[model samples]
Target: MDLLINHFWELTITGLAIGAVYALVALGYTMVYGVLRLINFAHSEVFMWGSFAAVWALMAVGAGKASGLGLAGYLVIGFVAAMTVSALIAMLLERVAYRPLRKRNSPPLIALISAIGASFALSELMGLRDKPLGWFNLENLRDYLGRPRENLPLPLQIQTKAVFPVFNYDVTNIDLIVLLSAIVMMVILDQFIRRSRLGRGIRAVAMDPEAAALMGINRDRVIRLTFLIGGIMAGAAAMMYLLKIGVTRYNAGFILGVKAFTAAVLGGIGNIRGALLGGFVLGVAENYGSALFGSQWKDVVAFLLLVVILLFRPTGLLGESLGKARA
Candidate 1:
């Protein structure tokens, strides 16, 4: 108890930082589910790819010795690479995996299977990218991936500095960046959806595809935009993750994706604001649970809470449909 009390703010801030990433990814899930009524399990890979893009961009830009404002410039390049790559892949996934199904009017199970297959295929490609390159004896790109599970060393190391007081603990640069950036991203999305014409079309389609089309809203365009927006957020999360954690692996997004998905469901799958609420709540819960149990059991605690939440509040704490989101 004394230990928990002593480190209260530490745990909370850590949870919030991690949770912000989860929220960014969770927004992808929530937005897709809202528009399509289907879970894009492969969306996790979108995040995984974003991380790689950022790291690869770092290598390409050679940002090793950058400091002060130069570090910030390099960070922007990495972020842009992540977002562009993620958005492209997400759009491709929608075109190949989901669009075909939608055109054929396939069952939801079929789409789910397609998503799973795409997820596995993307992950394996990231893992065994070298094998294919070796087939052509192309050694350059092979070296880029390094290894399947090895940590991809970060180039620009952004030092953490205490900036503000939060309770009895000092909030560091990392915490401030993660939290504020996440909040800003979510707010922009919320405003876009609530106030913009394109956003209105998205909501209309989420409400009813047939009627939306009859009302002159292009369903295809809306769906693509949804995927693009979600992908961009995932990319942002990837850059933020790299900044905060300072390393990544081929499959790093897998576990984090699961946590983010839980966050989506915990907040009400289709509700935008709910994703934010869920992510923070889960993060704090995981931290507190880890303090009580052990660090090794954090995953257990996260999933257990998900199960408990579902059992009690099936629609989530802030229950609302995407069409009627209380954002």
Candidate 2:
């Protein structure tokens, strides 16, 4: 309690920074659930892939020990690489995994199982990426694989300098960038859904698939678009995550992905704003709980918070459906 009170501002700012990543990842889960009524477990792998892509892209460009304009340029390359890779992988999941099942009119349970399978497959593919290179006698090029199951740190070295002070706690550039970037992305998505023509198609399908089809909204196209949007969000989350954490692994997304899902459920699974709120709430709660107890209890604190919240309001904080969101 004393620790939390003393460092409350610091915890809050840093927590919000971490929460920004969670919120961006949660957007993927929430948006897909809003449209398809199915959880895409493989979405986590999409995030992991993006992180790897970002790292690989930076490494390819020899981005290291950069500062000022050079650092900014490297970041742009990372974001572009991560977003592009995540988007393609997301679209591919829809085409190769979920689309076939949807065509067959598979039960939701079956689709879920497929999602889980796809998640494992993607994770393993990254884990074993060096195996193919080894088989082809490309030992010199396999350094990037870095022992598969181990941690892969970013090549760039980012220094954290405090930008301002809040209640005696300094807010660093990373914190501001993360929080602002997430808010901007969320606002763009919310506006896009509210005003765009394709957005209406998405809302129509979510509201009633049959009616949407009857009204000439292409159901297949809308579904693809949903996955694409989710993927893009996940990709952005990946870049932010790498910026904050500076390290990743083949299975890095597993735990974070679960937390993001909890955030989505906490905020109202289908509500875009709900995801944003839930993520910040969860992040703050985790920090406070850790301060009260210990660092090891952070995960426990987060899930416990979710359970307690759900017990009282199962519909979530802003449990409005995407289809029902106001323009």
Candidate 3:
């Protein structure tokens, strides 16, 4: 029983760490959905790009070398670079893919199709570029920007040679960093939406675009800002993801994006707080379910939870009709 309890706590911590990442990614999905009433399927790709960006940046800064300013410094530089690149890419994607569609006043179906196409195109680009990118060598920019050739070692290490503290819990430094960063980001986002002018614009547009425009809010600008914020969040998630699980490939975002999107729905689409809650719940549930039924059924468990939630509490735990209410 003691052994089981120990393992449970460890797994719980691991689950929360992962869940924090999911929550960050889910914020992008929920935010866009709330304001535009559209599911940005391509948001996952934004995350993928962010991860690649960080990997590349780390390599550029000689992160993998045995003698750099150490892992901590490398991580700081890598994260900032990755976030910047991801945000830019996300904004561009919005402009090229969704903005034009919105301008055309296209039907939601058409917009959805556009998102699918953009996702495929982006993924295919990564695939075609993957081979030339090389492995951990970091010679070319692609090598830096691409996924690792091999899987990163387990973030945790156990010390068998220690007499005093025999069982060392060596959680990955990156994981802790990622978890903390996510929390910081959430707080920043909360403040932005609650206290900033841009946030006010976002809320106003979310409530009623026509009214917002009537009040002199640039509807287009607000929409763009929404995409921008979402993109930045996705980028941050990407950095943590690569650090936690090193190998990156095209289409990586597809599965992750889907799960994050599910979380958004589970939390009641368009509710920021709901997204956070749903993400953590899903993460923990998935981890425990995998522990109980094996990894193969983990995804099945997540979907089952979604189904049960929708069937019973469609509005989610905290997602009431308060979407229109200012944060």
Candidate 4:
């Protein structure tokens, strides 16, 4: 308890940064689940690729220094690249893995299977890029994918220089950047879903597909848009993760994706605001639990919280359907 009280603000700032990542990733899961009622298990790859996209962007421009206008411009470049690539990949997944299944009116199980298969294929493809294509001298793959156990290097490192103090904790530039950027995204997304025309279409479809289709709302387009939005959010998260942790791998997204999925379920699967709420709460709780127990127990504490929450509030904290949500 003393450890917690003394380092409370430090832990809190850390949790919020991590929770922002989870929340961004969770938005992808929750939005898709909201409209399709099917979890896009392959969404992890979407996030992973986004992370790579940012790294690639920075690498292409050879970003190094962490401060000044040049670095800031490069950061924007990285984010834009990440979002573009992530959105494209997500759209690709929808077209290849999901579109055919949906057209065949396949069972939900089939879609789930397809998602898992796509995920594995993508992961292996990244992991083996050097293995399979190395014979062709196609640019050393070690620069990006490397061996399965090895992590890809991120050249740009955001120096965690303190800009302000939060009670006893010194808040850094990276902390504010991540938290504020995430909040901006969430606010925009919530407003879009609640007030925009296409967002209304999304809500309609989520509430009733047949009804939405009958009303001349193109279900296919809406579905694609949902995936795109989710992908974009995941891209934002990918950027933050790379900037904060400065390391990534082919399968990096798998665990984070699962945790984000749990955040979605914990907050009320189809609700946007619920995702935000669940992510922060879970992050804070996990940090506190780690303080109470030990650092190694943090992951255990997070998942355990999900189990406990589901046991008590089966529908989750907010429990509102996206269709009916005011966002």
Candidate 5:
């Protein structure tokens, strides 16, 4: 019984950490889908870019070797830098790739194709870009964020080791930070959507663009805001992901994005709270499934759950009722 309890606690902590990352990434999907009803497949690349940006920033600050700043300060700086860069890139992508198609009254398929093309382009750019354009190297960004180890003076290290429990695993500092950051961000976003002027515009656009426009809402501006908000969320998620996993690659976002998208759908697409609920649920389910079956079957379990959910609850846990208001 003790052993089982220990295992359960370990899994719960792990699940929560992973779920937080999923929720961060999933928010981008839910927000974009809420307004445009288009899945921004390029969103994964936005996350990738954010990871790379943080890496470059650390290198520039000479913190690549983990030489400077307390842990909190390092994280704050890295997250802010990453968010800014990623948001800018996401905006550019929307303007260059998505907006043009939207303007032309192109079919949703066309927009999807554009998203795919843009995703590939960003990945290729990371592969080819000389001098490592962002703050950190893509290859090492994950490790830097996750472990963040530095060499301390031998005496200080020995003293610190003597004082602190070496293997205590209630929850990692990284895990706590990620969870808290995700909660704060989500709360702020929820309030923004419910209370702010732009928030109303966004809700209005999602509900009915024609009606929103008739009410003097600027559709283009609202659309841009949606992309920007999604991009910012992705950037934050990318930072958390790297911190948790400790490494990244140019194509890392592909699988993460797919899973997050699944989470969005699982919670009921276009529903804000649904995305949050779906991400955590999927994260716990995936971890538990892997523990029971094997890591290889994790994906199968995720899809199976989705299929089962769709079979019975076609509208998802929250249902399509959320979209009815907009409809």
Candidate 6:
């Protein structure tokens, strides 16, 4: 309690920044659930793949000593690389894992099993770096694949320079970049979903697949678009994760993915805006809990908060159905 009070502003700002990442990742989970009523567990790998893409892109450009406009250009390169890779992987996951099952009218349970299988396959593919290299005889790629199962660090180090002070806590450039970037992305997504023609198709399918199909909406295209959009969001979140944490592994997304799912459920599984609210709340609460108890207890605190909230309101904080989202 004392620790939290002493560093309230610091915790809050840091928590929000972390929460922004969670929120972006959570968006993927929420959107998939809204349309297909299935949990795409493999979405985590989409994030992990994006992280690697960013690192590789930065490395390719010799970002190790970049500064000024050059550094900014490299940042853009990383984001584009990550987003593109993540989006492609996401679409592939859908086409390979879920689409076939849907075509067969497979049960939701079967689709779930496929999701789990896809997740493991993707993770192991990254972990077994040598197999692919050996298959292709790509000796030069060994540097990038380094130690099959080890953590990969970013090529460039981001300095944490404080940009301002709030309540005696210095807010850094990273904090503003993370928080503002997340807000802008969220607003863009919300508006796109509410106003675009494709967005209406998504909502129509979420509300009633048969009716949507009858109305000339292509359910297949909507599903693909949903996965694409979710992938893009996950890709952006991957960049945010790299900026904040600076290290990643093949299985890195496992824990964070679970937390993001919790955020999705905490906000209402199928609600877009609910995900944003839930993520911020979870992040701040986790920080406070860490201060009061210990950093090790952070996960416990987050899940406990989720349990408590669900006990009272099973639907979630802003539990509006995606089909009925307000403009």
Q: Return the TM-score for each candidate structure.
A: 0.95, 0.97, 0.86, 0.96, 0.85, 0.97
lDDT of 3 by residue, 159-274 (tens): 22211221444455445676788889889998898889988888888888889899999988887888888888888888777766665677778888998888888887888877
Q: Which is the better candidate, 2 or 5, if ranked by TM-score?
A: 2
In model 3, the clashing pairs are: 56-144, 56-145
Off by over 4 Å in 6: none
* lDDT of every predicted structure (CA atoms): 0.88, 0.89, 0.75, 0.88, 0.75, 0.89
Q: Give the winner by lDDT.
A: 2
Candidate with more favorable, higher lDDT: 1 or 2:
2
TM-score between model 1 and native: 0.95
lDDT tens string, model 2, 1-327? 888888999998888888888988988888889889999999999999999999999999998887789988998899889989999999999999999999999999999999999999999998888788868898988787788888898898878888889977989887787788788888998889888999888888888889999999999999999999989889989989998999999999999899899999999887888988898898888888889899999999999989988988998888757787555
Per-residue lDDT of model 5, residues 28-74, tens digit only:
88878877888889988898888777766655565532322555566
lDDT of 5 at 59: 53
Output the worst ten-in-a-row residue range by lDDT, candidate 6: 318-327
> Which residue runs does candidate 3 get wrong by more than 4 Å?
1-6, 65-69, 130-172, 320-322
Ranked candidates (TM-score, high to low): 2, 6, 4, 1, 3, 5
For candidate 3, the per-residue lDDT at 281 reads 83
Model 1: per-residue Cα lDDT over 214-250, one tens digit each: 9999899999999999999999999888878888887
Candidate 4, residue 81: the lDDT equals: 90
Q: By TM-score, is 1 or 2 better?
A: 2
Error of 1 at 26 (Å): 0.5
lDDT of 3 at 114: 84
Q: Which stretches of candidate 1 lie over 4 Å from their true place?
A: 140-142
